[model samples]
Target: MSGPRGSLVGQQLRVATTRFAHGGHAVARDDDGRVVFVRHALPAEVVQVRVTRGKAGDRFVFADVEAVETANPHRVTPPCQYAGPGGCGGCDLQHADLGYQRELKAQVVAEQLSRLAGIERDVLVEPVPGDVDGLRWRTRVEFAVDREGRAGLRPFHTRDVLPIDDCLIAAEPIIDSGVLRRRWPAQRAVDVIAPSGSGSAADSESDPGSDPGSHPGSPAAVLVPVPGGVKQAPEVTEHVASGPWSGDITVDARGFWQVHPGAASTFLDHVLGELDPQPGERALDLYAGVGLFARALADLVGDEGAVLAVESDERAVVAGERDTARVEQLEWRAERVEQALEPLIDGGDEVDLVVLDPPRAGAGAPVIRQIAQLSPRAIAYVACDPAALARDLATLADAGYELDTLRAFDAFPMTHHVECIAICRPSSAIRG
Candidate 1:
């Protein structure tokens, strides 16, 4: 409850949360017109907030709800015990109703688009098929290890770890893995992955010969060493099928894969629908993690056309190459997206379409400019963060690309995160 440097900490002020903002905070303005971002608060609620972070002469400060004077009707008790003040920093909107959380995310996305991109459109956040009321959807989770070898998650913006026996949003298999029951003395972190399938067992290097029946469908855990090499490395094969695209994807068990089971297929269907790839159209898939989108683009473009996939992670590229070997039309470039994009554009290859699924940072102005110079008829951008997407869309708009269609998905239920699919086309082509 103390601010940075223990100054201005514990200063309580009554304010009404006016609206939702990025990064899981609700916006409020003090009487002096200084901005205050209140956590664990909802829009339209009047609450007493205790300053948690601030500096002298600062225009804004971060605070936590000390007490709600007027609570929103949609606010519900968080399902997880370690989900409030001084609890784990995993889920931010757990206090809100599931449907309300999606609505808030949609509002955040729309606001970001309107403010940053100067574009306005009706935004509907459609829910993914899986998950039980926003519970048990995460297939993977990384737990931080304290100095005492206890496993837990870090508190928000702090190095302190709060021990937890179970995560409500984690898949059932991950909870059954008993990862929380064990200690990780030599490792600073541990990743538990529940691969798709039933009747599997938890496998860890610490307990090599452990029985599989200890917890049916238990996930596999890999130790992340603090200083030395990993004690045990694990790889997982993910099977995905969506909209004429079906295949098995190989990735490092600890690497980037959609935590939600239905996220990949759902995003793929939307991306493909937006791009509408032709049978013999050459395409580029930027930031192609494990070649998920690139594989689908290859299937659509056929052998006569080519699908080039560029990724920064070498391990991801290796796995992508191995998993996509059967698709001869697909090519993998193991380099940073910006670096690879320059040569592709300089080479003057006629790119018919571009599919980019950038990380949370999103592809910045430089990358967007290069893609625009390629003069592709259409570009499909899959963004996980709305603010980043808006910034990049503004750059694309400046480069003479117009937003054709946009769709948002409630990919990470019970959380502030939402996925957006944006389709853009060259203004000249649209005019023609």
Candidate 2:
């Protein structure tokens, strides 16, 4: 296919990958020295790539590995039959060993930090506690419904849905729900959530029958979206145990909860460890979905201190308020973090600690600057995108906050997605 200058849409080229880049692509230079981002490839591997996107004038082109002439030692056969080129685009590194997947993820985080934030540091991606061999860890999945009424996942960068029987990364309950078996001609997609909590927090403390489908081995909830309207999702309880703290938080089934079973508890441990919220200290939990950090902070800070949580999702705020109603020190605000921060900043309300768990697009510059202005003793940033994290870290540095420590976790296995918890402190604290 040819365009104004030259489009490499269907062109084939043989290139040797040089290194791993962000977004799960391997960097390689074609004969013309134009950069090519090859998917399903590894560093130092020679592979045949088919250009999927880009033009001659573009700085880089996106390609898929058509054939591997020389495979890397870490390369392994993909467990899923629909994980390769022109197949399901849900997973990226399924062809590589699980351990190697973490190594590549670490490299990507380090590269993003160096390139975007001008901070060079070796990063290690640790595996979360929950998955076995990086399989069946996804507690929630939304499958798209095709024209034929079949449920499946879409390919990378396309809306075309490919029907599949199973997803290796999905939790067993999600598959057991028989979501793919049923056909929905009127619905666009189906969302399934399998709460992995054994109800250690809810079941032991309260009646086991309080929350249905959230018991130790209950079936997953299959939600078929109503056409032209929202689905009134049921409330599901999630239990988190970290350090000396263990409790349950109720969230809307379709709300923002960690898809990885171990992600919430693991991140809570790290965040608490990073910012040791002392008694009589104020804290802020931005983008606090169901007040996960707020509850923990309020527990440690006690009634003498305060913890304010801001979440744009009204449903999440309502649930959080209801669940944590006994904690008098914790406050819930149903507003965007940026907007909420504005009032706090203008009112000169300084917090001793801050926890930022923004969406995939990071907190951006404005929010970072606002948070930095609060001059929190310590800030914990939980980021899912390294590139976005790096950009915000740069802004934080400019605002006189320095990175104290960073820990990366392979929260989403099989895919290139990695979670990073970055701890930042004021320049004065670092200097001391």
lDDT of 1 at 241: 80
Name the lDDT of candidate 1: 0.83
Cα misplacement distance, residue 76 of candidate 1 (Å):
1.0
So what's the TM-score on candidate 1? Answer: 0.93
RMSD of each: 2.6, 4.6
* Number of the top-ranking candidate, with lDDT as the measure: 2
After superposition, candidate 1 runs with Cα above 4 Å error: 1-6, 197-205, 211-214, 217-232, 429-432
TM-score of every prediction relative to native: 0.93, 0.93
283 Cα displacement, candidate 2 (Å): 0.2
Enumerate residue pairs that collide in model 1. Answer: none
- Candidate 1 lDDT over 41-140, as tens digits, reads 9999999998888865678989988888899999999999989777888888998999899889989999999999998977889888779889999888
186-296, model 2: which lDDT tens digit per residue?
Answer: 667777777644321111111233332433344554443433367576677788999947798887777899999999999999899889889999999999999889999
